[model samples]
Target: MSDVILLAPHDDVAVATRDLVPGESVTTGDGESDGNPTVVVVRDRVPRGHKVALRDLPLGSEVRKYGQVIGRTTRPVPAGSQVHVHNLEMPRMPDVPGASDAASDYAYATEHRELPVPEGERPTFLGYRRADGRVGTRNYVAIVTSVNCSASTARFVADQFRGRALAQFPHVDGVVALTHGSGCGLVPTSEGGRTLLRTLRGYAAHPNVGGVLVLGLGCEMLQVDALVAEAGIPADTLVRRLVIQETGGIRATVRAAVAEIEAMLPELDARRREVCDVSDLVLGLNCGGSDGYSGITANPALGVASDLLVAYGARSVLAETPEVYGAEHLLTRRAVSPEVGRRLIDRIAWWREYAAAGGGTLDNNPSPGNKAGGLTTILEKSLGAVAKAGSADLAAVYQYAEPIDTPGLGFMDTPGYDPVSVTGLVAGGATVVVFTTGRGSVLGCKPSPSIKVATNTAMYLRMHEDMDLNAGRIVDGTASLAEVGREIFDLVLAVASGRETVSEELDLGQDEFQPWLLGTVT
Candidate 1:
């Protein structure tokens, strides 16, 4: 196997496939210099998954990878030296061209490939059909709290289903308390409060939820009545409402909530899963704990699956706004229309101002874990992160937690924080999420299953119990990108059919329903 992998012929750096020793001769090919490859001795020890300078670089020169400018050289560096944070620097934001200039590269997907699964033989999964004609991958009874004050009572209500309490209700996937830290303590009419209210309403009306019991502390800013009204709970909908102030206390509210769920269970349990078309699926894409190989392995593999889904007329949501800072140009250019592309650019501009106000910048990413795994600048990280969207034409752009009403690949504006970003996706009606990670991210989203895909073989083996699939095989040369992508697409069908993911089996989703909190706490 090759010791290093060259992503592009024009790339000034190559990724070390294994740990490289100093003073060792490294082989090169493909005419990177003088139309003929030449050997270059290593100047420093390069760790596995790190980059090696293919040639000497001068100060302030752009460092290229994935055929794009990832960073600039901080100082002159010798060929074969380890290229990382110490020698690399982020590009000036002002120097980066706006998405408007990128519109020239924008083109709708004109080459239509044959469907992966034949039209007549398209795949189907067993899912719960809701009264509104929507299908759900899971049958969850959600106890939603309107404010932090009612969180404990909500938890107490869900705790009634601990262990095999719902064993008789085979169709029920267990009750979950969707609680959060912010709901009150702010102006109820403010934009932040409204966003939070919308998030709660989305969960209540989500198809995956078989029944909903909205619990609230009546005095809070987000009123129970307004929430129920906004959720549009039909007269026949299986939903109940309780307020701590109205019920006399926390214990009473908990008791009422438990009784309400029990009353709703027999019918909720009787709802059986039936075959549903692939178009009924809405998949959310996310990545965290990423490394240098993430773009080459798991991310692009997931992108293929995204493309397949888009081809089938299903919707896929790619989120993590801050994470995709430097890569917005790619998506904007692929947008189905100029307006759609402009919408995406607007969101990027919003993030820019938001970060600046907080005395921070977009380049403040590639967390310590990412740096340790060989990633340097946000540009490099963003370039890899956007691969999860596949090559599908951008269908639309939505605000954080806004309902996803499109039928193809769409982008949702969200933070880079894993749980918070996914929370927005789930609220937008994503029934399943495929999360790719290089350093291992153990995450789950209630009402939506999260399938973790590991980007490296070693991390996959070490955390096999936590990861749901291994895309690392592509890096190992055991499988091709398309092959592993098909594997992931199939797993989505299986997991949507009720196969629990590693995180789900470990019971990790309940606490992860964190709505993106905006504005001041006061």
Candidate 2:
């Protein structure tokens, strides 16, 4: 076993594969590139999954990892020293001149050509086809709340069918009450209200939801009739509408809602999963509870799967705008057109102002857990996060909760919060979500199934019940990057075909439906 791993030839630091005591000599391991194989004496106690300086660095000198600038030295450091936030700091790089002002130096074309999926390996999964010509991976009965005041009533309605009540309808995945924190307090005509309405309508009209019963309080700013009208719910669609105020209160509303759902059960259960092409799939890429090994293992492997999805003519959506802070430039280079690239850059600028208004900065990331896992700066974290997108050309940029109509890889603007981010992805029409985490993140999106990939073997073994796949084997040499990636792609197809994931087995999606509440609450 090797003691250290160097990701790239020009990297000035190497990652510690295991704990190293001072005065011990370490050699480059098989896990990394073979450029820097010389042994270096340990000058400090370096923990596993952390970085160690391979050479001396002076103050303000840029440190390189993944062949990119992660940060700069805060003070002079000797060889073999452990690199971390205390010794390194994020570099404040000025925005590129005219990059956002116009399409200056924008090529609008690149070497981004699609590769062919092997003829024998073209895959398909069983799915439910909807009236709108969209396909869904899961068949669910959705109870949507029009306002926070009616959330409890909606949940109660869904709860009536909790146990063996839905066993008769095996085709139905589950009865889910999709609730949120905002709906009545905001200005209904404001940007925040419009955004909220868009999200609710998206979920109500989602193909995955076989039947919907919209629950509302009669006096909220957002009216149920308006949402239904804007969402274009057809008369033939299996949908019901009810207001608690009109239904005589919580008990009456729950009874009415249960009766309504019962009437729709047979219709929802009649819909069965049929074979669908890979092109019918739309994958949402997200990462949370990230750690040092995330970039080296799961992220890059997931990137391979993303590229494969793109090759199959499917859509892949990458999100978390703040998390992509420093690495937005790399994505811009892969933009399908100059306009798409500029849209991404503009989103970056918007995030800067957005963060400032909240009395925060983009660099205020890499939470305490991230720092403990050897990630020292948001620049470093962002660089790792972008690996999940692979090298596919970014075809479009979308605002939060906006519809995604493109067929290739695209970017959706979202905050770094996990639930909020996934919520936006689902609203954007992502049929399935693939999330990679180094520290265990057990998460699931209601309408879309989430497949969690673990970055390190240790965490995977510890949380086997919560994780779907072990990507950490790439770092341990048990599997190559492509091998694990293929496994993920296969698992995705299986899950889309009605297979249950860890989070699904635990019944973890209903409480995770969080919409991004943009603007003020009042």
Candidate 3:
């Protein structure tokens, strides 16, 4: 067996499957024929999951990985040397001709293909069906705060329901306090305010939330009454409201909020899970702490699961706009319409400008953790990140926290930050979130369950308690990609049918309710 894995014929580098020492030899194809293999002697220590030079690279030449340009060589590199940040740097975004023409110049929908209809009976899962025709995987009573000032009181109220408080109410999934940092100190009509409101509304009206308690400080820019009215929450949803000032103080507000939720518990618990079709599922795909094997293993395996769900008429959302910087063109080609393709490009342009204004660039990715895991450039990271969307056509593009009503596959514009990205996905109505991590990121979402998949076997073995599944079995040669993907697909349904993920059992969702704060704080 080969010591290193070469992803493509034109690739200039291969990933070391395991740690390597100097003087060891590795072999790869000569790019002309598989029969004539080329041998290269190891020149330096290559850590497992890091890239190794497949051929001698001259300075200023492009470094190809996954058959795409990841970066440029800073200096001459001999074959078998470890390729990383010290020798490679991100290249500037290519200025494609007719980029000024925007969406029209791209061949939109050229690669669009429809999923074949299944012949047998479609799959089904047990879920809580809401009055609005939406299906939920969990039933929870939510304590939603309107401003930062009321966050503590909301949490205190939710805390009152812990332990044996809900032992009798078997259907209730416990009270969750969805709190954030910004709900005041900004204009209500500004972009930031609007975004905050949208996120709050989405959560309040989410199918998983059977009841909600909207708490506010009364003096904040986001008024409690205005939020409740604008949200258009279904009349059947048991909702209660409280203001800190009107309720006297924190102690008084907590008491009132607790009593309200106590009264709501019986009704919320009365709702029961019923059989629902697979089409009712909205799967959210996100990745963090990525390594070189991420694209080759978990992300692509998750992509296959995403494609399986999309084929069943389910909506699968792929987020983190900045992470897809160098790979937007790939998505554009799979767009179902020119308008959809244009919107994605426009978001990328906005991100470029947004990053510049902050004295940074989109290339400010592949975090330090990513670098240690062998990812050198944002371009390389993005090429791998885009694999999570699979081959599904881009049916729609949505702004942060916007309601995801489209079916098949969609993209939501969000920052590369893990908490913020998953928060947006949950707020946008994802019933279940599948997070692929190469470095073992423990992230969970309230209301929406998060399934963590490890990309490499080492991380999976180290953090087995945190991960729900291991796609690393693919790299271990113990399982095929399709097999692990099908396992993930099966796990999604199981979780939707009321199985608890590791994150859910660990109670890691409450602190992750972050809203994307845009515009200005002041």
lDDT of 2 by residue, 430-459 (tens): 989999998899998997999999999999
Estimate, for each residue in 329-379, the C-alpha lDDT of model 1 and write its tens digit.
Answer: 788778877788888877777787788789988899989999989999999
Winner of 1 and 3 under lDDT = 3
What TM-score would each prediction reach against the true structure? 0.95, 0.96, 0.97
Ranking by lDDT: 3, 1, 2
User: Using alpha carbons, what is the TM-score of model 3?
Assistant: 0.97
Q: Model-by-model lDDT, in order?
A: 0.87, 0.87, 0.90
- Alpha-carbon RMSD, candidate 1: 2.5
Query: What is the lDDT, from 0 to 100, of the residue 431 in candidate 2?
Result: 89
Model 1 spans > 4 angstroms off? 28-38, 95-120, 233-236
Model 2 stretches with alpha carbons more than 4 Å out: 29-36, 95-111, 232-236
Give a tens-digit lDDT track for model 3, residues 376-483: 999999999999998899999999989889999999999999999988888899999999999889998998999999999999999999999989888788999899
Candidate 3: C-alpha RMSD to true structure equals: 1.8
Point to the candidate with the largest lDDT: 3
